[model samples]
Target: MLSEFKAFVMRGNVLDLAIAVIIGGAFATITKSLTDDVIMPVVGWLFGGFDFSSYFIRLGPIPESYAGSPTNYAALKEAGVPLFGYGEFITVTINFLILAFIIFLLVRYANKAMARFEKDEAPAADPADVVLLREIRDELKAQRGGQ
Candidate 1:
């Protein structure tokens, strides 16, 4: 059983999956930074400086005014407020779309690259000598009434 587990872990598919997961984590961080730090700021600037993260609807027993800005969703939740956090959702959805598209592009390029590598790596055709030998043998057999 241990050997089987080791074999499974060492299989190409498993190794590929592990690498993909690590790469995906890193890609997620990059996309998150792109969205949060770069894209969102541009979006906000275009919309007259509207910060989406701060856009939420309060629903529970909380004052209309909070003394300090909440740093994160947990802080707002801790404030005993039922909230409609649409802005965060929108941001997350945008991030997901961007990540998915980027992955798609990567996969597409990888497939194309793999195809090109396969074409390059394909075994060359049999030598002309081998081909001529086979043809001569066939002709001799035909002449000998071997049909």
Candidate 2:
């Protein structure tokens, strides 16, 4: 059982999966930062400085002791107000779309590269037995010609 487990762990597919998971984690971090720091700002600017991150609708009354501004979604929520945070959802959806598109492009390019690598591969070396057989056949042909 242990040997079987070892064999499974040593498989090329298993190693490939492990590597892919590690790379995916790093990629997700990079995409998150790109969305939050770079893309979101540009999107906001394009929308005439309207911050989508703060867009929300109050579904419940604000608490009487709430000192924060009513328009502040975070503050209203912190004050125990039931709100529908649609702006944050939109931003998150945009981030997901960007990440998915990037991953798609990466996969497409990777497949192309793999295809190119396969096409450029050198032919396999002849087996020792085949080489010996060919040599013997050539020697027999040469002896027959000499006769």
Candidate 3:
């Protein structure tokens, strides 16, 4: 059973998946930063300095201001208030779009690179071999004619 488990763990697909998961986690952080830090700020500036993260609808009695202006989502949820949270949704949607576009670009580049490599590595047909074979056939035809 231990050997079976070891074999399963050592398989190429499993290792590849593990590596992909780690890389995906890192990529998620990068996308999140791009959406929240870079893109959202620009978008907010365009909309007359409106921060999306703060644009939530308090379901119950609305507080004059949230305590310490809690930046984290969990804190807002814990405040015993149902919230719309559209700003966070917008940020998440932007991240997803950016990640999708990046993946599409990567796939396109990989396909182009594979095509170039295949073209370069293709075996060239020998013109000399073809000429030699034709000459042998012509010689055989001449001998048969003489006979």
Best by TM-score: 1
What lDDT score is found at residue 104 in candidate 1? 94
Give the alpha carbon lDDT tens digit for every residue of 1-147 in model 1: 999999999999999999999988998999999999999999999999977877777666565665555545557776667888888889999999999999899989999999999999999999999999999998998999964
Ten-residue stretch with the least lDDT total in model 3: 62-71
lDDT of 1: 0.87
Candidate 1 backbone collisions, by pair: none
In model 3, the clashing pairs are none
Q: Is candidate 2 or candidate 3 better by TM-score?
A: 3
- Tens-digit lDDT track of model 2 for 13-109: 9999999999988988898899889988998899888788799989988888888888998788777899999998988888789989998998899
Q: Rate the local accuracy (lDDT) of all candidates.
A: 0.87, 0.90, 0.83
The better candidate by TM-score, 1 or 3, is 1
Off by over 4 Å in 2: 1-19, 122-147
Clash totals for all candidate models: 0, 0, 0
Candidate 1 residue runs with Cα over 4 Å from true position: 63-66, 69-75, 123-133, 145-147
Among these predictions, the greatest lDDT belongs to 2
Per-candidate TM vs. native? 0.80, 0.70, 0.76
Poorest stretch of ten by lDDT in candidate 1: 65-74
Candidate 2's TM-score reads: 0.70
